[model samples]
Target chain A: MNTYDDVERTGMSTQDVEETGMSERAVLLDFPGADDLMAAGRVEPPSAQALARALAGIEAAVAAQEAGHAAGRKKGAVATAPLRGMSGRRRALVGLFTAAAVAAGVATYTNTGETPTGTRSETRADTASVFLNDISTVAATQSLSSGKYWKTHLTVGDSYLSKSMDFYVVNDGKAYKKGRQPDWQLGPKDLDWKALNQLTTDPAKLLQLLQTPPRPKSISPFDQALTLLGGSPASPKLRAGLFKAMAGLKGVTLVGTVKDSTGRSGTALEFAEAKSIGRVIVDPKTSSILEYTFTWTAGASKGKATHQTYLSVGFTDKIG
Target chain B: MKPDTRQHEERSDGAPSRDGGSDAQLTRSAAGDAAAFTPLVQAYSPALHGYFARRMPGAADDLLAEAWLQAFAARRTFDPSRGSARGWLFGVARNVLAQHLRRAGRQEAVPGVEITDPWQAVDQRLDAAALAPALRRALAELPVEEREVLLLVSWEQLTPAEAAAAVGIPAGTARSRLHRARGRLRDRLAPTGPAGRHLSVTGDMA
Candidate 1:
């Protein structure tokens, strides 16, 4: 009998016959009792554990922030905590930020429309604050300023991290390799460790370098790499610290509310970008973020992605 | 994942249970109705659990917990226009599973074991004993992809489209896989041994 004879026996449609032919070529294509297996197959959920860990972290941070607030109140040093960027850069113009908050606050901005304006901490000045403004002006005048430096602290979701920079405007300045000590090398090929080290130590020297461009022959590949990492991309969403660094005002954007593991209410916030995109889970009643995450993308190409690495950051109120 | 304890005062049959609307349900849940979400949990939990267990390690409880937590955390991003609430929950849980596996560094193919003797379960309703051994041998011999497609369809009862979704393959691929699998099963059960050398073209009783 012809192979076509079998296909035509049941008077089946041409499409059905073709489908059957394709499947017949592959062994084990049609499994029996697929329904029962699917019904029987079930997996336990893991969100509960993750949520618990996150809540513990949030509680610790909130408690710490409160204690610090209490201590600041006792010292009469303006109990308001300062706002910071993703990299923890404080606003150079605190007075302006405070004025904007006060204006919004006076207007009674609250739960209205899709997004609501919330309360902001009152502003105050310190040595670090004054230094930040100077650095801002330098950065503004020259994209790459010589001998300028700035040190700032940043908080992600609830956990805090630190960043420091000694800015130098090297017209042809070379970058140093990451994690290399200044005394480790010398010569024309080796960048001056003394000058490179100034960004981390001497703010005055850093500022001076910001004013003068470095010789082209002294530039290093390591320095070029650092510039690339710190450089801003085209996408606004990808710039984690851009708005806050430029505006000097950090604010929370409330997307909406969600229920948590304990059957309690919580708020969700989009706090990261494609490279580290994640949502912040916060206790709605307390207005405290219990946990957050940094999402990492992976793929063969730098831009295209195949998988993700979700790094969850749990916080406690005590650490804040 | 906190067991969604919200009490949904609605009936099934794909009908709206409340006079107010779905928005009211969301609002009430958002407003701290811990029990308001109970109906939703109960209804979708079985489906979610079943979906994951068939292919993975069968740790339904743990997977369900993760899925539920993900659904709750991402509730705000849930847009009603795209799909059903249950479907949205599934999407969220799927993402959670991907994250969980990545964190554990245990990304590998965990194939489901084939039931050689369906009668081993001793179910009085099914005469699986007659068909079990042949089915088992046939299944075990099939290629991994084919076996998976077959089991998910016949036993799991997932529609061809849904099965395709789970396996992360196209429905057309799943349909072709199922056909090949069935043909082999039919050939193996056609009674081609010693004394029973009679070919049963009926495609049963090997």
Candidate 2:
């Protein structure tokens, strides 16, 4: 009897028998007959040694992460992460390079402790150095491990620029998770250096544009928390307005030294400029700004060249 | 931070396996508790392996390893109230797999290892072994969503609810798709004549 005849005799519906056949056929075709494939030198289930090796890799990774945490604790790493904001100026500086160029720049600057030269008017500085100069202390820094960092480049009439943000962090050695609430208000979005640079490359035009701040459609959670906690980053025109509003507020200074368990110590300093322009952080000991950064962009507009500088402060603990 | 060390402490502390722990414990484990997550790793590794192995052939081992690593690195992001630890883990694994595929720029199938059904073993009129590969190819030919639903239920052995959870689809939609996929497969395997449409073998179909 044919296949269907046999199914009919066995009291199976046409559909049911067909399903059984199809499932079996798929298994048969998807994998060459295991016995045949094995005979032809196919590897069977992963060798036990391979599995052990995999488990070892996992165990090592887990151990390293734990050790990092313990080391952080010993260094007086703050469990409470501060509001680390990416100033509009800092973003504009790095967004002008391609991915390859960005990678090269990050590698050179981070490894040699020197800044990568770029076409922008300002001298290139390592992101950490910029933070140190702006903030007295840095909480944490980890390079992108997933190779997913996209790089971009910027240019005006004669100048082309390449930049990179090799390491990202908060103050006092507190690691920043993407979605966590900030201790103070930063911004509503996670604008990378590239996106920022694009906005501010022309400082004059940027200042003009800032007269009416562009509203981002979606804001990140970190920015949301930052807004709730304290001051916010405003448009250039609004920033000027904020400085005017908080002009009478007393300016305060904060300073502190953070030493990781590894014996790596960095100093942090914080300055409340106008309360509304927000606070500026700088490493008094290293004379580096660990967090706060500013960039000015100038693009031609209305037949006149213009420039605008944006100010942002890093979060660091210091007494001033 | 080793799971072994954590395991020892939990034993001494008289805390139950993490799967049996309160939400707080699960949350802590997700944050940075290596020891707290040991049970989670043990519990879900098999299911995760099975999940990948059934869909993409030969990927079971690598995907499993990557999934575990991702689960740990991203442990902080896990939201316990939204779903179970296993469900969250499977979601991460799927993302990781998608990322890997996108980066690698190659779509290669890892051949599956076949397991025979015991009932079919006793009545060997039709060799199921001969049918498996054909079915697999046919399944591949189906739309990705339909094939996913079919294999999720048939190969991965997930009930409709569990399958829906894995793929982030509604249960009823998944059920309907599964039915259509199976029906499509059957039609392809043995073309049915219009004459056969009148017969309803199971009183349910009429």
Candidate 3:
């Protein structure tokens, strides 16, 4: 029937069918077959194990449905989610790299613990060191379970650079998924969860490894400490070590309590850059990071800092 | 962050096809009949998977599961009189995709994955991939709405009406979009003297 026979069933005309066929041929040719995509996408055919997981999610659905019905049928009865807000600078950072590069932002690995030799500002003194050692102790007291992958969702509030279209274009910068909020995947690329847990809680080793590569050039050791310590799903011991290591950095100093743009209150740590002030907010209660904020300390973009908040960070049972 | 720029030369395939009578299976599934849902899943999963695979690679299965989960949870609301179960399912899938696209960023410059060059991995004709790269460029140039309709109709093998139902647009609008998209494609893919090889390929399609 030349595929035209199915027109009535498909609600399409003969010409529509032909054109669709032509165009569809182009799409289908891209993949070898269903299995090829399934493999690439890591999609398995509803195995027994998967069915169990589906059943669990389904149970949540049923309970939500029953609860909603009991409460007179809410519009949100479907029981799943997605979200947060957008920031321009956050978008630029996420947009600059591909999903693999951005999601796996810290994929670069360097086993060597050779600290880059540089000037150490003696002004940091013993006070900051003592305070940091104390915070790392608190970090060590945290008790959280391990998971498969570490996911972090963040948004940029304001433009990182001066809001100039020509400059933005010349920089060849991209504001990634401006409309769609994204959660970054941070494990399985350069380091695994086990390796992260096994690393000693020593500050020097933490600083040496993190200050390697695949990070933005503007990222200082303090910023590196924030990204690694704030963004990772590190174990309590490792987190403690990271906090201590960060404390040892010359420029990283505690800035006391602060509230994120979301109005969530947390202790703030600020890193002074030439033109910007980078801040990491840690939830004092859990010894976990809450946000990484950047404010323009000087220049045309001065006084404008964008805060990137962590929506959720956890270990999933498997890669999605 | 740059969008895809690779071109593909793929081997030809047979005519497009569809799976029908899913409405009955969907009705059966709603009645708590697990077996009834099996046939329906088997029949329609490919189209749904393909729908997501085109826009988001390596996410089809997860997205597909999310869609089905929504579909099954909301099965009681399915009104066959309004449209085909497959179309309704497509709508649910689109919702799931919207969520994923929101939750995760897209890979704009996905190589060997773009519609232009499916044959990049396949062992086939060396010159079969569009030499002019006009088709893909034209595709990129088409309006997002028009492109969605064209893709649904062409890529998903949905009739204009079904595509409309899937995307929640009117059937007439989808038809117009389909027509406009085809016209734009024709304009861009039109024969040029030096692109005779591509001409033969697209001409065969025409």
Best by DockQ: 2
Candidates ranked, most accurate by lDDT first: 3, 2, 1
Root-mean-square deviation per candidate: 20.9, 20.8, 22.3
Model 3 CA deviation exceeding 4 Å by range: A1-320, B1-20, B31-35, B105-132, B192-206
lDDT of 1 by residue, A1-320 (tens): 01111122232322553455532211222223322332233233324543343333233222322333344455554424333332322432443354344334322222112332221111111111211222222222212322222211122111221122222221223422234222211113233323333322122322233223334523222222122112211111111112113122222233334554444454443432334334444442322233443344433333442221112222212222
**What is the per-residue lDDT of model 1 for residues B1-206, given as tens digits with 9 covering 90 to 100?**
12111123222122332323443443344333423444455445555554444333333444554455334333444435433454345454455445434333444343453221122121221233233554455555555566556655444334454456555567789778777666665555444453123223323331
DockQ of each: 0.06, 0.08, 0.07
Interface RMSD of 1: 17.6
lDDT minimum window of 10 residues, candidate 1 chain B:
B1-10
Per-candidate local distance difference test = 0.35, 0.36, 0.49
Q: Of the pair 1 and 3, which is ahead by lDDT? A: 3
Candidate 2: where is the Cα deviation over 4 Å? Answer: A1-46, A81-320, B1-26, B53-60, B108-129, B132-138, B186-206
DockQ of 3: 0.07
- After TM-score superposition, the amount by which residue B159's alpha carbon in candidate 2 deviates from its true location, in angstroms, is 3.3
Better of 2 and 3 by DockQ: 2
Candidate 1, residue B69: the lDDT equals 37
- Native contact share for candidate 1: 0.09
Q: Which ten residues in a row have the lowest lDDT in candidate 1 chain A?
A: A119-128
Candidate 3 overall lDDT versus native: 0.49
